[model samples]
Target chain A: EPEVTQTPSHQVTQMGQEVILRCVPISNHLYFYWYRQILGQKVEFLVSFYNNEISEKSEIFDDQFSVERPDGSNFTLKIRSTKLEDSAMYFCASRGGRYNEQFFGPGTRLTVL
Target chain B: TQLLEQSPQFLSIQEGENLTVYCNSSSVFSSLQWYRQEPGEGPVLLVTVVTGGEVKKLKRLTFQFGDARKDSSLHITAAQPGDTGLYLCAEARRGGATNKLIFGTGTLLAVQP
Candidate 1:
């Protein structure tokens, strides 16, 4: 089965540095999403993209966060400045066809020092 | 903001035991989905329930949506060690470029061999 894939399985960055988390959703899927899970907390929605634009975003997805489909296959989330609270497991997901299920990638663990 | 709450935040049981995880919300859901996530990996979709009072079974795991569409449950019969993971329930918000998933607080299960 084809699955979403993310790069840099683990990322460590300075508190004020920028980091980009990359994902390649399923080859034919049209919708993409980003979610984060703080250690010991619920997975929280960050943003959703479709038609090459952001569809929705949460409060956590403030000015510091931006998403782009820079190429046909790559969906990337960029954090302008990292913070200790931004450390979490970030997952990328995609949905296609008529199903409600969204397939997820293995996730990128972001650690800000 | 709506929140999905899952009960029994942690469960530790021997293999072959039965278990049930509950996801509840004060708000009604358009649809409910269940996912299992292993550490360092993204959540894998298990089941999706759309209608009120719907029941769907996938092998030894059974999922049911509440009659009011405000809750759902996952019941595992004869669970194996492979079933150990963080189980999450999520609902797709209605209006977005692409509906984004709002996940529930997860239930972490540890099935011992």
Candidate 2:
């Protein structure tokens, strides 16, 4: 079965540096999303994109965060400035036009120093 | 903001045992999904329940959506050690409503042999 895939399975960055996490959602899926989970915490919504626009975003998705679909298959999340507290696992997901099953990628582990 | 609460934050059981994990919320959702996440991996979709009071089965695993669409349950019968993982419940994002899902804190199940 087709699945979502992400690049840079793990990343380590210093505080105040910028980081970009990349994802390639299921090629046929139309909707895309980004979520994060802190160690021992619940997964929190970050943002969603559809029809070449942002459909929704949570409060946690502040100015420091931005998402882009630069190409047909590439979905990316960029953090302008990193902090120690930003360490977490970031996940990317997508849903196709039918059945509405949301598929998830393996995830990118972000570690801020 | 929509919040999903999962019960029994952690569970440990012997192989061939049975267990149930729950997801509850005050807000109604268009659909609810169950996912399993293993260490170092992102959440993988197990099932999706859209209608109130709907039930679906996947081999030894069963899922039920509450009548109010505000809660869901996952039951595993004769669970084996391979069933061990973090189970998460998430509400589907409605169109124009933050395309992101609201996920529960999660239930970590450890099935030992």
Q: What clash count does candidate 1 reach?
A: 0
Cα misplacement distance, residue B13 of candidate 2 (Å): 0.6
| TM-score attained by chain A of model 1 | 0.97
Q: What lDDT tens digits, residue by residue, belong to model 2 across residues B1-113? A: 67789999999999998999999998887888899999989998888898899999999999999999888999999999999999999887675934467688899999999
Give the per-residue Cα lDDT of candidate 1 at B29: 94
**Per-prediction TM-score:** 0.95, 0.94
Q: Backbone collision count in every prediction?
A: 0, 0
Each model's lDDT: 0.92, 0.89
* Residue-level lDDT for B96 in candidate 2: 93
Residue B39's lDDT in candidate 2: 92
Query: What tens-digit string does per-residue lDDT give for candidate 1 at A1-113?
Result: 89899999999999999999999999999999999999888888899999988888888999999999999999999999999999999999998755657889999999999
Candidate 1 displacement at residue A44 in angstroms: 0.4
State in Å the error of residue B88, model 1: 0.6
TM-score of chain B of 1: 0.97
Q: Pick the candidate with the highest lDDT.
A: 1
